[model samples]
Target: MPIQASFPSQEPLGLNADLIRKYNQPAPRYTSYPTALKFKPIEDKASRSAMLADIEDAEGPLSLYVHVPYCRSLCWFCGCAKIISTNTALADKYLDYLEMEVRRYANLIRSGRKVVQLHFGGGSPNFLSPAQIGRLDNILRSSFEFDPSAEISVELDPRTLSKSQVLAFRKLGVNRASIGVQDINSKVQEAIHRIQPTETNIKTISWLREAGINSINVDLIYGLPHQTESSFNQTLDEVLGYDPNRLAVFSYAHVPWSKPAQKILERSPLPTADSKIDILIQTVQRLTGSGYAHVGMDHFAKIDDPMVKAQEAKTLQRNFQGYSLHADVEICAFGMSAISQSKNSFRQNQKDLDAYYKMLDEGDIPLEKGYLLTPDDQIRREVIMRLMCDLELDFQARGESNGVDFQNYFSSELDRLQVFEEDGLISFVEGGLEVTPLGRLLIRNVASRFDAYLGDAKQGFSKAI
Candidate 1:
């Protein structure tokens, strides 16, 4: 069935300028509690094999994440693990190694394990040839049985996406897609080095819909260079015309130290901190006012979309992909720099392509780093995920489930929140604390309070605002 959607009346959010200014310092996006920055290097494959064995015995449903780290060229503001190249031979070689890696895991996982979700994400997943995408899909399907309700999705750059590729996605049973159109303003696109015209994106969505791919997501970046309030409003209007089922409005993280390409943006006239806040306010007003439900931080979905349903049902989950609906499925990631997650641990593949290929050639998993969640890590992760997804926390219920007083356990964190509470971004209710609408945009700051690894506060994380 096509994913249905609706948006109820919009709630007025308090845009606390003062609070934003105070808390708008470097902070993690909280995709994971410890975050990948805290991942410890794994020297061998024994632990990985053991974990897979444990999972196989449990025999739960699964989610597969395949990373394609190739892009035709670099977008100056891009921070993802990506390789900017157009060499088909390079891509073909990577896929050959990827097949070996997938087969390795497939052998470890027992037969007939169901895959409920599969996602292809990267620098640009569509950079591969049509046949290449099909081959990857076939290899995965051959290894695991796909659930009838499986949701297959991909992230593609509209500038590089083509009609034949859209047809290929349909052939592979891709039901959902996210297209990148950071900004429609020519100057902004020029500054960012991603020059996709407005009509090109509209046409891409049209093609996907015509090919029976109805669940569409469009990504927009706020706080980019030359992004004024007026220009951002115009971009929002242009994007709303596409009427996407889901929207991800991300703040442009300008971490030159982490992503050297971002250094190119240094010479450009970027928006000031206050101006970025204005742009964020404008974006929220436009999207929420236009009938898009504010599902959570930087994410909006149609009221009836599965994400919204997940939120209403309190089953919403947050991972590297941001907000997601399937919480029961363990994630298995393939390709260089892909990160996989099970209930007990998070593992990452080798970030270097050469190292990844060498490990596969040596008949071993190209595992580089991972974090095995301790009992404490798991509890803290639960708290952070809840605050991020549901925007509220029931202290009593949380404590009851874990056999500890949540308030007493997290007293320091709760005490730290006094600043947010005083600033009116958050408030205490009947049994627990509630993040006000003002706190929604600053949810990362709220979630960070519970992070045990976020010491020093000097780490190179993006700003909260």
Candidate 2:
């Protein structure tokens, strides 16, 4: 059965210079409260042990994030940490090291926490063969007690998928597949060097459906070179024809200075700020008109989708994967450059594969950087998360619930948001601040108002849009 869309379009919204000026500022994605850049390098075994002990003491089920950094080819627009390789031996060796780290963490947390959610993100998880995926699944099961109904999901590169591989994913307990389809325009595809045809995507979608895996997500990107309002509309039309359960419409973050491959793309041809805003407004209108419920920033879903339900119930959570079903679970991330968040702290694995392998070879849990959150960090995190997830925050309610005086703790931050209140971006009511309809487009900016580390001169985050 097709899921009904939830967003309704009334009038086509225009992007004026003032709107562009207001929204054209840099901001973090807020995947974590402090963000990964704030994490300091772990000094010794004691710090690492303390982090592991915290994870061991967590009260509920855990979430696992495994990063597979290998990719068959590079997409110029991508800023992800990935290694391009066709060598099977390299993958085999990487898996060995990954298993070692998994075992090391398992031993540290001896109670064997049950995994409630397991996500495989990548360079491309599909870069591994079906057999390799199965073997990796075995490794996880061997080390942890996976809940029978755990949401096991994987990010797939459609260009590399095979029919057998699709079946193998299901057999290996993958219940969700997120496929990347940046644009269907051939010219745009060529410009980005990611020439995925619509036929391939449709076939993969059909196969996954036939395999009884209905939780399909399609990722689309706007603001790429050669992308125009017409081109994007066409892409959206084709995407809507597929009718995915979830849609992630990301704005392209072109940071050629940071990500060298991005230099391959000609900067001049990329859309202007006004042009980008036009595409975004049009895309949002189209999705909403098609009955897709706006599931906050960069995401939309059918009314019946679990994410939509979560949003309505005010239980939606934002994580590295974007919006998630399991937010409260302690995230245990494995592989190079992965990050795990416990209740009180954040821990990250080694970024370089060589460094990661070296640590595991020496029987150490290759953690590179981390932060132990203070009580203030927790309070600010709660406020920021509420704004990001629910677009509202109850100051007094939070204070009462968490036993922290909201005004005393965040008095300066609240004062900072007064301008937004004046601009009608937010509402200051009796006990809380709620984002207005216009504020939804500036959620990241609004959330950043509460981030203590965001205003530093050294911060190099992307634009909030």
**Among these predicted structures, which one has the highest TM-score?**
1
lDDT of 2 by residue, 1-465 (tens): 111222333333332447546866888888889888789999977887788788777777888999999999999999898999887568888898888988878876648568888899989988888888888988898999989999989999999998888888899888888999999999999989998988999999998999988999999999898999999999999999999998999989888899988888884389888888888878777887786777777888877788777766666788887888866788889999999888899998888989999988887888899998988788777778767877778777778756978788788988999998877677887678777655666788889888888775435887866
Evaluate model 1: give its TM-score: 0.95
Backbone clashes, each candidate: 2, 4
- Each model's lDDT: 0.85, 0.83
Lowest summed lDDT over 10 consecutive residues: which window, candidate 2?
1-10
What are the per-residue Cα lDDT tens digits for candidate 1 across 204-279?
9999999999999999998888999999899988998999999999988878887888999877899999999889
